[model samples]
Target chain A: MDLDSQEQILKLSELHGPSQLMVIIGAPDPEAAEITAETVVQGDPSYAGVLAGAQLGLDVYHVLDESISSEVPPEVWDAQIGVMGDVLEADALVAAVAGMRQPGSDSS
Target chain B: MLEGRYVIALGERDGISGPAIAACAEAAGAKVVFVATECFV
Candidate 1:
């Protein structure tokens, strides 16, 4: 049984890893997200690294843009991979702020 | 022909909108720029 799965995965590093702070106004689409991920898989195998079993924080951002909810669909990616549901930068900032208020007070 | 981030600026006005995207895409040298009316995303 020779599956030869090597050619299956794909990569999109150029499209991936934009400045994390990038703020765009676009719609959310899970199906489109999967299509894009699949495109990466078929186009470049290393795309697995960009978005594997779980899509990285960056992948989530690209699949949709909710900053302009009034103008775009609120839940184009409502279910599926669940990428649109999470926002990492907000979490990181919350953690950073909480760390500042911690007892040890590592940095001022 | 191009690389790095590209910003596409267009006036919301209709008359100038027709050729706006093409001009920007060419100037930026992107292979393609996905565009569709997003009356709903």
Candidate 2:
């Protein structure tokens, strides 16, 4: 996550608590998705931003995740995200972030 | 199933951009508080 985004997340967490906030990631690849998920749940792995060592443990999900996609309107999904689904490894991206959400999973 | 939730959208510039993710969140009735699209690599 970028510094600004990390800061915003920190502020939001402080203001509302981690349980009250959710993060949606739209990364194209599994690696990117995992990294962002790690940032919100375990803290920034790169240790270069405000989220470094934060360990907010906030709920995070990929935009393509079934739970999220199922809720999105088909028309909006087709218009804003349909094309990317054809070009990216949607399953891997979903699993990468999903792994981070599981308790005691060796994502780190 | 994100109705009444607070959301922060982070997306890759080349794929699902921040605004696009924000739209999806809004469609689900989540209140999107921030959006940032950046290059991952």
Candidate 3:
């Protein structure tokens, strides 16, 4: 990664104290999801810490279904089930929905 | 508040809602370690 990216990661890493783990879930493009995940995984002290002490871990989950719309992807159900299982095991859960605007909705 | 805490973020990748939520979580002191998104195609 570049220096800018590394700096951002470092900033994010400082947010968590000890004994902290976070799980993020979203859907649509897998690449974007992975990027976000890497930010935490590679930014955390435990995962990327060059020091001696232990570090925390970040868990990322990318769903294939769109939660904002009524239509469901063919494989989303299974993915949801699996993600739910992971959520239950996580210390905390966060739902990141980028664009929540519905179809045919006014932008104004 | 969210210091040393775990969080789960859920949303879509088509717009600003997903990332916005994640940003909010982080702003609230929650570490967004994981990310999952639904396919728009």
The lDDT values for all models are 0.26, 0.86, 0.39
Off by over 4 Å in 2: A103-108
Q: Write the per-residue lDDT of candidate 3 for residues A1-108, one digit (tens) a residue.
A: 223333433444466532354444443333454444444444423333432131223433333223211132324433334344343322222233123212232111
lDDT of 2 by residue, A66-101 (tens): 889888889988988987887888899889998898
Error of model 1, residue B26, in angstroms: 2.3
| Best model per lDDT | 2
- Candidate whose DockQ is highest: 2
Which candidate leads in TM-score?
2
As for candidate 3, its interface RMSD to one decimal place is 13.2
Error of 3 at A39 (Å): 3.5
Model 3 vs. true fold: TM:
0.32
iRMS, all models:
15.2, 4.6, 13.2
lDDT value for candidate 3?
0.39
Write the number of the candidate with greater TM-score, choosing between 1 and 2.
Answer: 2
Residue-by-residue lDDT tens digits, candidate 1, A1-108 = 001211211122334332211111122333322333333223322344423342222211221223212222223223221342353233332233232222431111
Question: What fraction of correct interface contacts does each candidate retain?
Answer: 0.00, 0.78, 0.35
True-vs-predicted CA distance for residue A92, candidate 2, Å = 0.1
- Checking candidate 1 for backbone clashes, the offending pairs are A9-A45, A10-A41, A10-A44, A10-A45, A10-A47, A11-A44, A11-A47
